[model samples]
Target: MARIIGVDIPNDKRLEISLTYIFGVGRKTALDVCRDLNLDPGMKARDLNEIQVTEIANHLQKNYNVEGELRRTLAQAISRLRDIGCYRGLRHRRSLPVRGQRTRTNARSRKGPKKTVAGKKSVKK
Candidate 1:
């Protein structure tokens, strides 16, 4: 369990993939970070030296607004849109798809399970 930038990277994974365990870092960013730090992408996280770990932490802290900061910034942006009553905001408020996906027939993942409506029974006179 190697802790970098306040996040514990999985020791089993390669350094490149393990770094992505930290929030706001993806595959591409992880590769870029390794390249910038002059680290071998295939190296395991547990094999990182103290200086290399420190360099990674410093680079992440200085160059990227990650973890809590990223979450807060995203939340604030969404809140601002909602407060302004924009169409996208309204979609978010209603818990509907915001990217113009057809909701009438699809979007089951977001809409959840459908409820059965009661119907009148036909009487045989």
Candidate 2:
């Protein structure tokens, strides 16, 4: 069970896809890492030797912020926005969509389960 950057990526998966198990690393970044390191992206994580694993860990630690650090950095940015009290910040503060998406009918995912009033009835004119 090889671990990288404190995350246990699946050993049977392809290197490029396994790399995405680390937070903040997407498919493009994983491909770039493979290109930069001259590694075979199609190789499985279990097939990698110790040197290759170490190279990936070192490269990620040196050039990217993942896991806890990335999470903290994002939290700080959102906190800064909230402190500034901007429109987006207000939306964040209210647990509403921050990207100007319609909320009248959709946004149930963000707004959580529906809440209904007791004995509420609709009347037709």
Candidate 3:
């Protein structure tokens, strides 16, 4: 395992994919980091030398807000929205989809398990 930005990336994965183990870094950012640092994106993390790992760690510290920093800022933004009572904030508070997806059909992920409400017995014909 290679520890980068406090996250232990999988040793067998390519450097670019392994870099994505750090918070706030996606595939695009990982590729960009490799390009900027002149590191080989195709190399496996297990093959990284100590100096290369340290260089990557130092580079991330200097250039990016990741892990705890990113989480804190995002939490603060959500709290601000909640405090201001915005529609999106309310949606977040309610645990529903926040992107205006129609709740009438599919939002099972955010809406949770279906609650079975008993209906009135059918009237006699």
Ranking by TM-score: 3, 2, 1
Off by over 4 Å in 1: 119-125
TM-score for each predicted model, relative to the true structure: 0.88, 0.90, 0.92
lDDT of each: 0.90, 0.92, 0.91
Span of ten consecutive residues with least summed lDDT in model 3: 57-66
RMSD score of candidate 3 (Å): 1.4
Query: Comparing candidate 2 with candidate 3, which one achieves the higher lDDT?
Result: 2
| lDDT for predicted candidate 3 compared with the true structure | 0.91
User: How do these models rank on lDDT, best leading?
Assistant: 2, 3, 1
Per-residue accuracy of model 2 over 1-125 as CA lDDT, tens digit each = 67888999999999999999999999999999999999999999999888988999999989999888999999999999999999988998988999999999999999888887699579989
**Model 2 lowest lDDT segment of ten:** 112-121
User: What tens digits encode model 1's per-residue C-alpha lDDT throughout 1-125?
Assistant: 88887899999899999999999999998999999988999999999989899999889889998888898999998888799999999987887888999998988887778867899999999
Model 2, global lDDT: 0.92
